[model samples]
Target: MTAAILLQLVLNGLAMGIIYSLPALGISLIWNASGLFNFAQGDLLTLGGYVMLSLFGKAGLPYIPSFIMTVAVMGIIGYALSQAYFYPMLEHRVNPQIILIGTVAFSVFIRNLVLVIWGTTPQTYKNPFGSSVLQIGELYLMPHVIWIVAIVAVLLITLQYFLRGTMVGTAMRAVAQRPTASYLMGIRNDRMIALTFMLSTAIAAVSGVLISPIIPLTPSMGGIIAVKAMAAVLIGGLGSFSGALLGGVAVGIAETLFAAFVSSTYRDIFIFGVLVLFLLFRPGGIFRASVSEKV
Candidate 1:
């Protein structure tokens, strides 16, 4: 294969991997905070995209404003879901496995609900970027892809700071680690939970809005992403943020390169095959979690 072809595939993979990383990171964050896996994150991403569709596509709002509104709106939805459903279950001491199942059910519910509202037709919106391409030497890159990389990079850096440096972030971590003690210290654990959900959903919104321009929006589109994100989280090492990101990029690149150099027909099979291999040998993933988990 030519070096140019290889470079192109890798760059494309990087863009797609960044998309997967958003949800994977969110999964890791929510898992750490609640010890409950949220299988509905992909649907949340779908909702975010649809919300952006309303604000930007139908209403003709500017991209920046639409994005901000989508994030705010989805953040509210996440907080509400936590306050109404997740927190209630926690208060009643619901089984963690049951809560996880609930997320899967919720995932299905969101897709159906979206169908009820948006119908069966796939949708697309005019991107303000307008099919622009950036050229550097012999390489050509899509503007949207570049935007994805830059935006996700900034988001990752900001998130690293938020979780490590900010008081709210610290309190949330404390609550996750020791809820009773944090309560004694006057940290409102409920608020922390709500905040975690808000952040996670907002991240989903970011992915949704970013991805909507690149792909047609379909009710079940999130299902494809949901599976990919789950795979990434498992392959990355559960509860490890960096691992989630790394795993996502790794999977994206592998999928793309395999499709390009090998065969496109069995690309997904190759992906799952890689997943099985990882499970067999490196279940903890490349950046192993401090606490390893078995597949």
Candidate 2:
């Protein structure tokens, strides 16, 4: 109720929002560019966490090397998924619905794979930064929270520049707009899709590494976050970059506020309740843009 209490809650919400935005952005990118729902995108998050766990927790590798290694490995896995599964499906002219199902199966397989390799025990990701609090007047902030916001901001800005300024980024946008026309324009549609997967998965990996310290790590860890990210995609425009940004932060703040003022148990209910309202009234999302596709 007090101003300081409100500020702290808002800060906490912003941190959670940043965490959700990473995967949500990935989901939005893949959907717009490839025209396929990557049901396993969140599993990439879990995989990143476990990979970091092995590097940092088990091998005693330093944080910078471990984080870089995890992102690299996840990017490779993303490209492989496109090559092994998505490419094969396209080659055989498989139905899009079937490919979507394949993603679901892939999600299940990855979760079980983690469960088998890491066991059912919940592991903790050690924060590379020691617990340090910053105090301003009556408000206290965690250093990790500031790091999360700053890191996501840098990544998002870099992505915006890449998409708007780089040749490859513009080509990818062309593919998203019209794959057939992009092909006519000499764009390699398949390669662009593969690159989209690689980039999106790398983003998911970054999210995993950043948030792992705050949450308990288990095979099931990515599931809830994945669901929330999906809702974020819906709330933000499905294909709008700025929409995803706005939707993620909005959802995070709404959920935190609801939990503070209402029941913690109803936090999810409130979040999804807003999602349903959006679905009914403004399915185009907070942004009113549509993904253009050639017929």
Candidate 3:
């Protein structure tokens, strides 16, 4: 590929990785805080897009107002899903396998629900960027890309600060590290877990809003992303935020390069191939979590 083409591909891959990482972070959060494997996380992304479309396209609301409304609605849905599906199962001490199945059922329910409500017709959101492209030397970058990257960067920084500086963030981290100990320390582990669900869901919604203008919105649009994010979580390490970020960018870059150099059809094959290799070998991922010390 030419230099500009190569640059564009790399940038696009990075943007895609950022998109994947948003939901992957949510997946990692839910997994770490509550040990709940949220199979419907991707559907939440789809839900956000449709919600935005409803408010923006149908309701004729302004962009900022529609976006704010989308976030509020998505947050409630995320928390409700956690409470209904995850909280009950965890409270009753259900089998982990059963919980997994419950999440899968939830996933199916959300997808089918979208199909019923949105009628399986592909939808697109109003483009906030309005055909804007950034000209950088020979490489032209889509404004959406710049926005995605900037938003992800700000999110990462904000999250880092929150986890390090805030009481609730530290409590959530402690819960992830040791739920029993956090409980002993008087932290409401259950509440923190629920909050994690809300936060993660909002993050997923942000991702959906950012990406909807770039692709056709459909109920099943998130299917591929869900799979990719799972790979990202696995490749990044199950519980590490930095690892998730790195793994997501890596996956995005790899997919783009493969599609450009090889066959677009085989790109997914290569993506999963990498995941299998990672699982077989460095299953702990690129950034292995430090072993908890017990005195």
TM-score of each: 0.95, 0.95, 0.94
Residue-level error in angstroms, candidate 1, position 47:
0.8
Find the candidate with the highest TM-score and give its number.
1
Q: Which candidate achieves the best lDDT against the true structure?
A: 1
lDDT of each: 0.88, 0.86, 0.85
Tell me the tens digit of each residue's lDDT in model 1 across 57-163: 99999989988999999999999999989998987888888888999999999999999998879999997766877887778778887888999999899999999
Score candidate 2 by TM-score against the native. Answer: 0.95
Q: 112-158 in candidate 3: lDDT tens per residue?
A: 99899998888886678677788999999888888889978998899
Model 2, 101-180: lDDT tens per residue? 99889889999999999998999866776777889899998888888898889889999999999999999999988888
**Local distance difference test, candidate 3:** 0.85
- Candidate 1 scores a C-alpha RMSD against the true structure in Å of 1.8
lDDT of 2 at 210: 86
- How should the candidates be ordered by lDDT, best one leading? 1, 2, 3
Which stretch of 10 consecutive residues in model 1 shows the poorest summed lDDT? 286-295
On TM-score, the stronger of 1 and 3 is 1
